[model samples]
Target: MPSVPLHSSATPIVSAVLAFDVGGTDTKAGLVLSAAPGEVPEIVDIQRFRTALDAQRPGPVLVDFLDGLLRRYATEHPQLRIAAVGVTVPGLVDEQRGIGIYAANLGWRDYPFRAELESRMQLPVSFGHDVGAAGDAEVALGAGQGAENAMILVVGTGIAAALYIDGRRLRAGGYAGEVGHAMAPAPDGGLQIMEATGSAGAIGRRYLLAHPDFSGGAREVLTLAKAGDTVAQRIWAEAIAALAFSIAQAVAMIGISKVVIGGGLAEAGDELFEPLAKQIDQLLSFQPRPVLVKAMLGQNAGLIGSALKAQELLSAASSEPSTGALP
Candidate 1:
């Protein structure tokens, strides 16, 4: 619900765009209306649907869902012109080719999303990595506004990163920001990757493995840790350690000025940030410690990002330069 009040009820809606964010477990579609002067753009008529997917071949189902939504919106809002469509999905994405290179959760490989969406909708399409697009919104409209070199690190069922360096996003064919896979010291005295040890899903999975009766995720695990459960404490500590190690590495390599944490685990607030900050300080020597902050746009960042993508598409097609700000 990104909204701003218009001054007058008589003012007409200038235009709107269709935006879809295909997340791991759900898909969200909404209409992003362009704001008139002195008003903020808003995402209205939002719909959330459980992602009904076929892991091996997700494109057809996804495309069908999007098309239906688009048609419905068109019928519902006849007054506003929908200029473009933006779709973002989790996975390795090649923005230049408009291909979803791969997604571990969704299990699609090299799917030509832009071509499929364009063929059906007949509109200018913008496609990108889900976390990357969310990062764009954060940079432009949230915590990362003034930073030249920053990162948006999303720790959820899995982990991914969006790198902004030299004041521009680094796609590198969608291979630039897979930091979750980086190696870290495991709590069991061996090496493990950050995602396996630190992600919200990983933390829950680890705790569940330790105590089969515990029917909850990282949140419950954190609660148990605070209540003096040794098993939960160990698991929570490992998650923190793994995350801190990975972040310090990014700071060393890229000199990241700010790391805007997003996704479910960020919901933990101080429990995640405080210890992660302390550990990161312990790890870095010469590298400047990046400022760690929670994402301001919350879960809506990706959706807003999709809207921004659509707006940009329309702007480009009409030969109008886009400022890349959130609509």
Candidate 2:
């Protein structure tokens, strides 16, 4: 979405907060404003930017980028008070400490993300893992809304999961949901990471290996499979099988009742779900199978999750005693 100016003469300014969701390839930021105390926050000025790839000094680069964005928003909306900021990024995050422990793609380690941003902006900040945050949103308002124990699997370029058990999010210090690394059977009759066999990127890579001249992605491969291309059909079937095996393992371990699938691969709809559900059913003997569903929030789930976090921060601040007030 295109960025909108913070202030407009025709639009009334209201209390607002800032939220950012940083992904591997792009970053999405939003300005959430509340028109009424009980109304849902209105999201505006949604914008996307290329993610910063400064591996050498990712801390400073990220801080600078966030600072610049905050400065611009403040400049444009002088009357609007941004009570808090929420940032969600991929990889391991120590949310309680506001530290980004590690992101292999971004090349950041033990980065004090929240402290740096809060020091610069003088505002409360909330930090979390991207998939975790997205899963929270799903539980609170999306596909997993009514499910107490749900697992959200994001199967795009890579595969990751957000696990909720008995209505509680299981972070495990950002290591709980790295299902992509789980073991799965490879075509060579050996074990490999589940992502290598099931993820959308994996499908594209495997297809390219077989047909180097087929310059298409996972979606294209699915299309070809639908048209009865034997190679594409084989690759797609393997992906579904691997994904189903992983889901079955998760169910056996955690008793998750609902599985919400999202990301680019989920776009295949019943083409992916029917086979996956059937496979899981065949794999499980005594264990109860989960109801597989698609993610309802689409790509905006992370951004919504960030806004929810900011609202929580704002509420906490409001309930705290004023330290600088005259008694």
lDDT of 1: 0.86
In candidate 2, position 296 carries an lDDT of 85
Per-model TM-score versus the true fold: 0.90, 0.92
Candidate 2 Cα lDDT to native:
0.87
Q: What's the lDDT for residue 106 in model 1?
A: 79
Give lDDT tens digits, candidate 2, residues 67-141: 788788777777677777889999888888889999988889999999998888788788888988888888887
Regions more than 4 Å wrong, model 2? 1-12, 35-41, 77-79, 323-327
**Cα lDDT for residue 188, candidate 1:** 82
Across 29-116, the per-residue lDDT of candidate 1 in tens digits comes to: 8888876532335888888978768865687777888888888888888767777888999889998899999887777888898999
Q: How many backbone collisions does model 1 have? A: 0
How does each model score on lDDT?
0.86, 0.87
